[model samples]
Target: MPEREPLAPAVAATRLAVRRALAPYAGGAVVAGVSGGADSLALAAALAFEAPALGIAAVSVTVDHGLQAGSDAAARDAAEACRAMGLEARIARVEVAGPGGPEAAARRARLDALRAAAAQVGARAVLLAHTLDDQAETVLLGLARGSGATSLAGMSPARRDPDGLTWLRPLLGLRRGDTVAACAAQHLAPWQDPHNADEAFARVRVRRSVLPLLEAELGPGVAEALARTADQLREDDEAFRDMIDETIEDIVEHAEAGIAVSVAALAANPAALRHRVIRHVVASEFGVSLTRTQTLEVGRLVTDWAGQGPIDLPGCRATRSGGMVVFAARA
Candidate 1:
């Protein structure tokens, strides 16, 4: 066991967050995403310090996006810092293929590296240091996309990856300043990634431009307000999702590319519940989620349609093909 040092407020908060996120999957190793920045480095330190008591170990992983000139050196510095903190650290360099565009390619590459590192260590989960500010940004971005509750609900603290590994964000409730403060309190110099300030990214635009404007105009607590809205929406969305799951157990049937909903069963439900059911079916089966306008279209399909007709959607199409409504991708 490592000697206990007095943890700073930021470090203590980080520790609590990490512990809460991993409580369900006790005693398993956690792969910490270390980007050489203050946020991730502080998270790495907290996890390393708390690991012994929790019966879990922490491994640091630095994904070199290979986009910047000194990215490799930055990754090496990150690994060295992790090693100094008594964590086993490794660097994964990834090539960013641009067919999907640079940002998309880099994101896929980064997650791929993180997943690969977790697999190598036999870790069941990965910890990401996304803060409260990030969550607000996500919510605002989702709003700008005109997407509904699920998109506005933003990221989950713990989500199962498609491959069954878990990805957790322990620092989601804390601010970026807190992470920087933690590094300063520990006498650690954390790197500032230049990309964070670049206006090329929408997130950067929101963080640097929109948030500041909102704070100035709305009086300082706008981020908290937005985050609160996201939290409430998340709760509502989860309940609705659960209802849909249970409803599907009774009302859904296998179809060609998607599922078919029994019109009689669906029509019996209240308007709000029926809307959620339709949204869930579109999102789950055909990977199509209705926007505000699309939701109205779906409502018409249920209530106003006197006869069978088609409703066009992104990635798929919906229609009253028979007595029951069917949603499937167009052949």
Candidate 2:
């Protein structure tokens, strides 16, 4: 008997990733955020293939940012591709106007549109096509900015938003090349966004030039190394978050103006956790982020406590009162 034809590696990899991701949400629906790009089209194809046998329902939602001419047609083509794959598809038109630049603003608008599409289909989760290359680029940017572990941690594979919607990125471990190869293997035509090639965006520069230079200078696996760093940091960050949540329940208390934590308890913990606690407290109570400087100053109120007056924060003030480090609203 003749040997059976082996499945293409790219097709096999994409299918495996989608199968693993759809397991948890079995018998439920999910929305795939497709951009008609190689990554997203590959994701939609994988979802189309894997979701059916698992009793999972999937929909493709393409957001038209209207940033360029013919964007609506692009959205329609994406949806038609999904339809050809035997999945329901939708197009959401959004105006990308916000504080951030075009890239950031488009992302914000796209996410909002995706969420609404998920809501329409009663999907509890939205699947994105962020690949390992994206994660590596994010880590590079984080490193360049000297950001905290939260930034270094890069994007999580899965995250639950406050509104009960979950975001899942199954391709975080797959390379951008894998997606491109998968699309080619399946004979799918992916739309190339002009913005991706435009060097005006910092991310485009990283993708087009910086990453290639790093790979040439260092080695072939530099991108993989950066992504691995992100994975390790994310694990550490998760553990610290669990610890902080438990500690917060024990030491935090309601106050007249805001919130407080036991000074002795704060001082007893290691500096790493102590700083996170202060930042968490201010963020939860005042809805403002504490800089590294601000976090250290609030931490000093616990360790030093030299009768310094309240140090004003963005939306609150920190002071040591009695046996508690109090964070109160700004007067």
Candidate 3:
């Protein structure tokens, strides 16, 4: 085999990241998501070079939301770019509509399409090109909304879905500038998405204005610090989940209508664990996340039960009965 030429530093960095991420899936097929942006283009290029050498079949899946003029053309161009790098490419055009506004809806639609596209090629893993900058923005958004630990944890580098598909973000440690430099080194022309510049979107505002301003005031490294905080919080979240699982196993019971938790166990726990237990029970049994206030109300049933009536939750009703905090399905 002919020896490949030396790669530029930025290109080498991205390829190295992708190579490491692909280590566990050497013999498996993967779907590389491309949006024609610098980040994804660099990712696709890296995958093209790395996957084949590791005996992995990598295909590029470009999802077109068709929300803007010439979106189809853009998708085609992205696919062609992947093909140029010797990767099999496919375009999945999806209609984006649902709750949580356009951005969230579009993301949901895109992931669904990507999963379907992966199924077509028998791939079990999807690669996303989210960078460290993206992670910082997510943390900032979580802080703004006063969200819990889960939201502040940001995106995981790798996660598996219950349906069997795995999501991998190989470039999570790299900055966005690294991707642009990588594309330049690889001689790839990425489509510049206009929405990225429009401050109308919250993420764009965070990227363009909020982060930069924070960096200036904080004397740099603000984004990196936020990303580090997310990493630590993710570790903490994993540990907390383990503790919750063990505690729930001991305190939970099957009820006539739903599940029940022992009031004795709830009272024995510290306040933090007590609140978390209340929230977890509702989320797991009823498939609804309670707000902080709702969780506290549920806890109060154990800590300060004054013969109050059943507390209505989103999908269930919590009642104190027979020394048990019972969560029954709402009729």
Candidate 4:
């Protein structure tokens, strides 16, 4: 008999990434969120190959946002492909609604459905197919928004959601082209989303125009550089979070209406940590994010105090009360 060809480099690389990602979840059930696109299809294929070896019972979930024509059929097709690879599959049909435009609404709905599916299937983790290219695009979008380090930090490889389901992205170190090549090597045909080519979306524009322009002008490796920046920022953000946790415990006190932080402590800390502490306090207390202007305005209550009256915030008010900066719910 002829010797079987070795696994293609791209296919081997993708499977290796998935294997490492699922190592910690050995013997646990995992759901791969497959969109039928090349990236997700490659992920599903890799999970199917590696799950059994790692004692993981894998399931592929195809979330149908029903945004486009034939979306349901496409979702079914994705599930069928997963089953063909010897993995259990599910199709989650979800209605895309709420604020934040169509793309955001669809994404939110899809994620909710994925989490629900994971719970139904008793899976502890839902693996996503976001690659290095996606991470770079996320960083660029964050930069465009003029966001802080936390926002620029981009997506983590693994994160546990509020519902206690872990989300994993194993391919963040691989390029999108690698996934495409892997699909081809495996003889898997991927469904192409037309929206990916539509320039109406900001992400599409970044992927199609902005990234190419950067690569052209800068020679190459722009995406890798952006992904590296995200990794570095994430490390810094983690350290800062640790510092904030320790400082908050000592400097924060429960107030009658809300929470209060020691004004002297906040003023003494460096501006970076102080601002984050203020933002964290407001967000944790009132569940509302403060704009930069709002944050700085509140900061002035400590750094540039001039007996300013109570400042009205979205869900609360910030006022100076002797030694503490009190954040009280708006009456």
The whole-model lDDT of each prediction reads 0.86, 0.92, 0.93, 0.94
lDDT of 1 by residue, 104-205 (tens): 899899999999989988899999989889999999999998877888998888889677899999898899889999999888889889999899999999
Candidate 3: tens digits of C-alpha lDDT, residues 170-208? 999999999999999888999999889988999999999
Which of the numbered candidates is closest to the native, going by highest lDDT? Answer: 4
TM-score of 1: 0.89
Q: Candidate 1: global Cα-lDDT?
A: 0.86
Which of the numbered candidates is closest to the native, going by highest TM-score?
4
Order by lDDT, highest first = 4, 3, 2, 1
Residue 115 lDDT in candidate 4? 85
User: Which parts of model 1 are misplaced by more than 4 Å?
Assistant: 1-7, 22-26, 97-101, 161-164, 256-258
RMSD of each: 3.1, 2.1, 2.1, 1.2
Summed backbone clashes in each candidate are 0, 0, 0, 0
TM-score of each candidate? 0.89, 0.93, 0.95, 0.97
Report the C-alpha lDDT of model 4 over 248-321, residue by residue, as the tens digit.
98999999899999999999999999999999999999999888889999999999999999999999999999
